[model samples]
Target chain A: MTSYSLILRTAARFLLPLLLMFSIFLLLRGHDLPGGGFIAGLVASCAFVVYLFAFDVAPVRRMLRLDPRSMVGVGLLLAALSGVPAVFFGEAFFTGLWLELELPRIGEIKLSTPLVFDIGVYLVVLGSVMAIVMALAEGEE
Target chain B: MSLMWSTEGAGLLEWVIIAAFALMCLSLGLATLRLLLGPTLADRVVALELMASITVGIIAVYTISSGVSDFLDVAVVLALTAFLAAVGFARYLEKRGHGDD
Candidate 1:
């Protein structure tokens, strides 16, 4: 591997967390807001890409454990689950519902089917981005 | 393509979307070039990743432009399916037990 150690280490330590948070923010605010799950996931995955490029894909994969494919499956399941409620409510498929829950500590954290959908979106994005990357990375190896 | 995009006229939002789309196209193109010309396999993978990011961005932009949330589903599937495949391949490489061979 090439030596650019400092750049790689710094990116993993400092840059990745911020990137992940930004991704979440984008996913959460996506409905009626400026961002969504797909964009957010890519942004988050970019951080991982930095890690993969800097160190190597093997260490990172081991560190994360559970192949990215599993996450992809989970994401798909979650997204589909999010839509099921619509059918139960006598609405057409994917009829999104927005609700709110008032919590004592965190105040009112709005919850909705859309948010659930976003979570699924986040997972899928995270999974797929990693999927393509790992495949290409290994192909090269 | 311009005609389709310009149906809404040159509003600020329209310009922004257009610019963003153009930028994504450029990035994807750059990544494709790298994938084609890379001296190493890893470099090609990285380039492929860069391309994927742009593609996802384009999806999001289109979803927003259309205001039809239905498009979001497509974006979700694309992101998950493609990324997972990448992960599977990575493990196959790691399991080879060939670390330094």
Candidate 2:
């Protein structure tokens, strides 16, 4: 077994949630800002990587609950599906469709197909990177 | 060089930013030298980390100079990557039995 450091483990535990939150924030603000799915996914995967370094591959895999390959598949499907609604509307493929909703608490909210696509990209990146990282880490043992 | 000394529109903040940029560039050059010349793997890793941090700082300074807050996200991601890289290197060193602790 690889030797672990208590300081590293403790830091990882504290950093995991913060990193995940920041990644989500990046995803949410990505539409108009510099943040985006690719960077967000990278950050999220880095969080998992930190955990992997502190512990082992088994626990990291277990914590993920779903296989990374499946995540990639799901992301691709979502990205493809996001463009389908445009076809139904008699528009060109991958045309951006937007919806505005009014809510009492949060006021008006704007949603778009591009946002969905971004989420898909986020998932694909996160999954692929994790898959590679986990495979390499497991191989080391 | 002209922008650094020109007094037409340059303010105190701009001067400070220019100074920061110069210092960051100097540090970056020094870190690169260490990364290339360090005798040990640990020293090289530390130099790499320093370079990464300087990169983040450069991004932040650019964002401020450009008046675009979006680049801060880049800084954030760069910082995260640097931290992960450091952790990964430490783990690698530990596995190779070079860990000091």
Candidate 3:
């Protein structure tokens, strides 16, 4: 992996940001559009995978401060907690709740508990994938 | 008869998706063959990766054909994890002979 050509490294330098943005776009649009948190998280983690391919795992670990295993737990907690609010409101668990807000630059934005759930799924997927990739990469070393 | 074709007639997008699906299936078949016949572990790993990628393509084609956008999530997840499988195999190969002691 470290012996990759200079061309690939240069290409990745530009491609990484574009891939991240596309993943975020997928995450945001997932509620109403073709994109969603699961796919977006996969895309985001793959972007890191691409980075790891071009470089290595140490920098990626540094960039992501927390352990990937912890990320998985945090994601699960966030997803479960997203449903708890609805339960407290006398709604069934995991019921979708919505909030409408008007922001200056973004204009009208709609938020929902499902979106939070999706975000949690995204994080879990990303973290788990990275954990596997990192563990394998470490073993190789 | 454009009207008649509506029932049996394929739209451009439909045709494209169908063509892509066929190509993916073809590749998947070839990958499967290689996976079965490969003499080396590395060749088998490559074939496995190819099959996984073709599966992703099949999922994408199904998404378009069925007009179900959510399957894209499945495709993305598959694509992401497929690489991990590859990495894991590679590591296993690295450790196979050297660490036996």
Candidate 4:
């Protein structure tokens, strides 16, 4: 078990949510900007790693609420499924599709198949990295 | 790159940015030296953190010099990683019974 440090614990408590939010921001702005799913996933994993450093594996596992390996499987499924919708439209696999919607309060929203693919990538990266890190940390104990 | 060297249209702000870049490079070199020569693990980790921070500074400076905001995201990611690296090192040191140091 890792020894507790008051300062590190406090900082990790605040940083985890902020880092997660930034990762989402990176994921969302990735299409037209210099952000993307891969980097965002890394950032998110870093957030959890920070939490793990301050606390322990058990709490971190509880917070996650699912096995990291399962996350990788679900992410892979989502990535494959994201391309299936294009096949329904008579397009080849992995073809980009877009839908634009206007909601009353939210104004305009542009949805795309690429976004789904990015989310899948994010999940895969986050899951695999966390699983590896968690295993290593637990082994250290 | 050419903009930094060209004296034709350089302003005070550009000169300051160039100076900032020079200072950052100098500090980066010093940090690298410390990382190579530090006697203790903690010193090496601190040096590494310093190098990470200087890299972030370089990115920020480059962003200002080039008038592109996109690179700021890279800086943000770098900073986050650096923070994690520092925390991880601290945890390792504590585990090894060197936390007081």
Candidate 5:
């Protein structure tokens, strides 16, 4: 693949972080909202895909020090572990669990096991999707 | 098509959705035509990309009309994979001597 114009590179540099942050936000709110881990991970991976298009795969690989396959493994582990917590609690597997915490200046924040599961899903999706992207971007370039 | 009229709120939102669906259909038809008739591999790839985007739009319209937000996740996934497929195919073409011209 050929390098894109300077304008695209510059724009992508500015856009990548925003896209990543948005994906995380999506993941955080996914249980109650339209967003989720799978979609968030896909969205985050697209940021890298755009970066790969404008620049190349080398920088992206360097940025992502961990291998994509490892990311998938870690994600699956997190998701599985999320379910295991319920098993230890003697609840049925994959049960929806929540925790309420009060923080200074921000009032109460609710956290849950499903969000952990979503994060795992997010990582899995990101890793798998980026694996495909890395294969394509690195091939014959 | 019938559901578009049958769903409640048959006012401006319904007409807007109908118009959006009509536009999506037209674009899908054009993309399919290009996919079939394009002389070059790049042209077909581009047509395929356009069709993917159109399909995403259709998914969004369906989500809106049905009042089910779950389908939006499907649309998001579609949009994400669509970009990946385009890049992969473009690379394949490059390896086949297209040279990314």
Candidate 6:
């Protein structure tokens, strides 16, 4: 009643790696591609889906060592704060702005604050699902 | 905004639509299957939560695809309301589940 069978636990264990990899792929391609942070987050939350299935919510929560909603709050704050750079540049809020640093060895790599915001969104979504599902799963136990 | 405006009407835009539609269908189909077949109340809750997140992803893609960030408004609404729905469903289930016992 408290934990999943061995087969399910194994499946859950393998699920996170696959999901995390896919989430990163989606996030990296977000700007020009259809994939993005929110989708990536949902994809990543598949790890939690497996965990909730593999173990009881309380045990999994203890292992996680973080409250999912609080994690979501941190994500939202980071995302919102990522917009601050726009204000510094006198651009509107949530402006898509970036910086390019050309290193002699590393080549021209472009980085954006928007990307950070997207990352925040990704975390927010994953955390949200984790929190909500944990509550429901707890009830089940 | 600049990205979308600059990339407007190219083959890439069409490709974006096709890929998004493909993923949307795939995820939604899976979610629907779980919704229909999920044996336990907790299973249904988890699946529905996934569906909500999927819906948000679709909306975000649509927001950029349609070249109107207005869809973000819809995304926000979905995010806010979806959580409320989860809470309500849990409470309702708690009551009904105990009643069954």
Q: Quick one: best TM-score, which candidate?
A: 4
Weakest ten-residue segment in model 6 chain B by summed lDDT: B92-101
DockQ ranking of the models:
4, 2, 5, 3, 1, 6
What does the lDDT come to for candidate 1? 0.74
| Candidate 6 deviant stretches above 4 angstroms | A103-106, B1-101
DockQ of 4: 0.79
lDDT of 4 by residue, A56-112 (tens): 888999998889999999889988889999999999999999999999998999999
Which structure is stronger by DockQ: 5 or 6? Answer: 5
Candidate 6 local lDDT, residue A135 = 77
lDDT string for model 4 (B10-62, tens) is: 67778799899999999999999998888888899999999999999999999
True contacts kept of 6: 0.00
> What value does DockQ give for candidate 2?
0.78
DockQ of all candidate complexes: 0.07, 0.78, 0.27, 0.79, 0.40, 0.06
Q: What lDDT would each prediction earn against the true structure?
A: 0.74, 0.90, 0.81, 0.90, 0.83, 0.76
- Tell me the TM-score of model 5: 0.76
Per-candidate TM equals 0.57, 0.91, 0.70, 0.92, 0.76, 0.57
Residues A1-141, candidate 6, lDDT per residue (tens digit)? 532358756766776576678678878778876678888887667656666666667666776677888889989999999988898899998898878999999899878987999899998998999988887767654
Off by over 4 Å in 4: B1-10, B98-101
What is the per-residue lDDT of model 3 for residues A1-141, given as tens digits with 9 covering 90 to 100?
A: 335547657866776797789889899888767778887887888888877776779988997898999999999999998898788789999888899999999899999999899889988999999999899778776
RMSD of 6: 10.1
In every candidate, how many clashes are there?
A: 7, 0, 2, 0, 0, 0
Q: What stretches of model 3 exceed 4 Å from their correct place?
A: A1-4, A33-35, B1-4, B7-27, B45-101
Where in model 5 is the C-alpha error above 4 Å? B1-20, B56-101
Which of the two, 1 or 2, has more lDDT?
Answer: 2
- In order, the interface RMSDs are 5.7, 1.1, 3.4, 1.1, 2.2, 7.8
Q: What is candidate 1's lDDT per residue for B1-101, written digit by digit as tens?
A: 34455665647778899899998888888889998898766667667767766777888999878876656655664665455445544444455534421
lDDT of 5 by residue, A28-118 (tens): 8787778889879978998888788778888998888989999999999999988877887789999978899999999999988898899
Worst 10 residues of 4 chain A by lDDT: A1-10
Q: Give the Cα error of residue A83 in candidate 4, in Å.
A: 0.9
